[model samples]
Target: MKTFPTIETERLILRQLRPEDSVDLYNYFSKDEVTEFYDLDSFTELQQAESLIRIFNDRFITQQGIRWGITLKTEDKVIGTCGFHNWSKKHFKAEIGYELSPEYWGIGVMTEVLREVINFGYKELELNRIEAFTYPDNIKSRKLLEKSGLSEEGYLKKYYYVKQRFVDAVIFSIIKEEVTNDERSKN
Candidate 1:
């Protein structure tokens, strides 16, 4: 089995998702505003959250992907999750995804988490590139990606089928070279 590592930021801890986190998971995922652009329907049952936790663990054990629970330093409750999905070891690339509770939105929490995760992707995972996909109308998400230093790559019409309808998506990406360049400039 693959071992997962925990990450800590100034205000948050990114750790492996646990089955006991179902209640916290269900809390935010149940909100329509939070799930409006998510690929799946708004979670209606606690069991759904529990099932997702299982999937999160299975992916790490199988070495396919990872999903870290975002918990604040002052609280044990999970406020969100973020990690690499669609990982390709041979290609040294992966897609990044995340969701946060509405209560914590627009507070720079995710930005802090993402900065650490992206560094982990390039430094620890040794990835060459990371990509993100978001609905075209999700301006906040797109802006967040850009703020994180990813460039808008392209658009995909009807790129994903979600909630029984085809949705348009925009792609954003960053490469290891870009990350290195940013770091060099900062130093």
Candidate 2:
């Protein structure tokens, strides 16, 4: 099994999740707009948030997957989470997922975190391909993924059954050769 490193970016630190992060997780995830596009259940209760965080921790060692708490260095606050989830070891692939507070939207925080996490996936985990699917309406996230070097692979119709609806998804990917050490170090 591969080990997870605490990745640091320009203004962010992608660290392991902790039980203490429940409060900030509840604050951001409770916003309907924040979780609306992501695949998480509605964040209604702090207990539910804690449960999810616990599962996130459990997945790391048990499944060889990664779930990071994105903390802003300046503020020392956990504003969001990101991960390579739903992994297929035989296929050498994983689905990339992330969520951030509405306040940090469009500020490139997610992009920085994406690069760091993708590096870990490619360099450490030996993943051959990393893919992510976003709702068609989530232009901000789509743009961030593209700008961070994952290309738009396709648009899937009604790809995800989320929130009791068949939501369309836009998929993106980063192949192993693409996550070059030189390029990853710059971001």
Candidate 3:
């Protein structure tokens, strides 16, 4: 199994999910506004979040992909989760996905954490490519990807079935490059 050493950003800690963080995650996910653009169903109850966290813990040992809990250093709260998944083994490619609480939106937290995780995927995990898909309506995430130096590739109409409706997904990505290496070198 592959282990992720703890990763730190200026105001946050990117670490493996824990059972105790279920409530914080639930608090974030339970909001209609937060989950409105995200793919997951809204967390109705706190216990469901705990159950999901337990499953996330098991997933770490399995090591097929990684889902990290984004925790704030200031408040000791889990603000969101992001991960690599939907892999193509032969191609050495995988899609990255992320969601954050409404409270943390527009603060640049996800941008910092994503740059760290993407570099980890390249340098430590030996991936050649990492990409992300977002609904066309998700301008916030698209901006984050752009700020991290990814470019829009194309649009896939009805690219995903989310929230019981067909939605357009805009694909954005970064190839291994000097720019990507530049992001990797930052502490």
Candidate 4:
């Protein structure tokens, strides 16, 4: 709402995605490795990326949810995206989704990003809970969520139709109280 919100991490800038980012968005989304467990397939055309950006903006306008383009502070190009999808204002909950280019995989980029976004979800969005649905086979994402303090709620069979066939997902969740307690421990 209101031009959408921008969040900044130590090494990344999380901001509203623009149509101009089509090229960068296409670059990552077109990669098979990046789209492996994603709900959508690898984009074959730039128009698809552009159209997705428009959809992202529209979602913000309608208050359904928001997707932030993740860019390195020193670079002007988008390297990935992460945000809340299926957000519910009435329930104060949202599901988190994210992806990163393989080049930036091993480093701690997403860890930093997730921390800030989760904080925003709790403090700014007043979300009571944040949920994540990762493909059961996506070990990296599963570990990332657990490492970030989101506990595994359960496993859902055929929860998502990824790449064609129905795929199971592992649900992980973090509550406001969990985040608050983690913050207090750091102080």
Candidate 5:
């Protein structure tokens, strides 16, 4: 955990977020469609992306979390990000979150990324559990979590107050043992 890990998949490279990625991050985050399910409003300025990059990197440095900037292997520009947040080493658990450019939606990009990230969480981080929460209306996210092998646990009412109002969330979780059993079955 001393150095940030870089994960690569067949068509993508998940790398550390750098200051140079602000423009790419801003391009998508500036769109209302991209932030519709996110807690933050559509970004209005470049500095907001810069601050977010700093915050994401800070989390890794503090051992609180890790977020990877997603890019295609042929290009360095970030199209989106995914990572673990609310990590608790003592509890051996963390929350997973991700967002991709709408352009990449329904194309299996996030699915591939989630597969690798989830494996890393269980193998490298030694996490016993990884969970995710999504706004109840986010059908795509809910489907993605299930496709990635997480089971829906239940609904949590008024879990977060975002955009000035309380909102409910649906939770999903996957355990290390479940993943192990899955890989065994696949083999």
Candidate 6:
């Protein structure tokens, strides 16, 4: 996609991250609770947020991946983000990542966002598979992925080195045929 795609749901908008969103991004990222399961440490500076926005945009520009800033339809400030990273067009697959403010947790926001984003992955990105990896202890994330129609694949022992230590990851994935069958069943 040449121009950034903007998606809207009943209460939220998934749009490209802008420089002005630095403050909102920093607000949640600076909180330890928000970054607890993430690979990176809690953001300590506003510049870190700014740099992250730049990297997200750069990923889209280079066709590496696309990350959308999540904001409420009633507000312009970003409250979270969800998108695909580690995209591989050749293999027709990508890894999904997301984070939301603690204040917005358990409100069905990420669930709605994932539904739309995953649809885009299959329809627009032509991806056959969408995968997510989370810390084994992140029950919330694992449950959310299951609710979103992804199935647990298995554990990857010491899959990632984060915070100066090796951490294990639980993999979840869904394929195009599964999504298609799901939609067909709903109809």
lDDT of each: 0.93, 0.85, 0.81, 0.90, 0.97, 0.96
Span of 10 residues, lowest total lDDT, candidate 3: 55-64
lDDT per residue for candidate 2 within 12-114, as digits (tens), equals: 9888888889988999989989987877766888997899888898898898578999998887678998998888889999998999999998788888888
Give the CA lDDT, 0 to 100, for residue 166 in model 3: 89
Name the 10 consecutive residues with the lowest summed lDDT in model 2.
177-186
Native-referenced Cα lDDT, model 6:
0.96
Question: Which pairs of residues collide in candidate 5?
Answer: none
After superposition, which runs of candidate 2 have C-alpha atoms over 4 Å from their true positions?
1-4, 181-187
> 43-71, model 4: which lDDT tens digit per residue?
99999999999988888888888889999
Candidate 1 per-residue lDDT over residues 1-187, each given as its tens digit: 2568999999999999988999999999999988998986899999999999998888888777889999999999999999999999999999999999998999999999999999999988899999999999999999999999999999999999898899999999999999898889999
**TM-score quality measure for candidate 1:** 0.98
For residues 1-187, what per-residue lDDT tens digits would candidate 5 score against the true structure?
8999999999999999999999999999999999999988999999999999999999999999999999999988899999999999999999999999889899999999999999999989999999999998999999999999999999999999999999999999999999999889999
The CA lDDT at 1 in model 3 is: 42
How good is model 2 by TM-score? 0.90
| Rank by lDDT (best first) | 5, 6, 1, 4, 2, 3
Residue 185 shift from truth in candidate 5, angstroms: 1.9
Separately for all candidates shown, the number of backbone clashes (residues 3 or more apart, or on different chains) is 0, 0, 0, 0, 0, 0
Better of 4 and 5 by lDDT: 5
TM-score of each: 0.98, 0.90, 0.88, 0.96, 0.99, 0.99
Off by over 4 Å in 4: none
- Residue 156, candidate 6: Cα error in Å is 0.7
- In terms of TM-score, which candidate is stronger, 3 or 5? 5
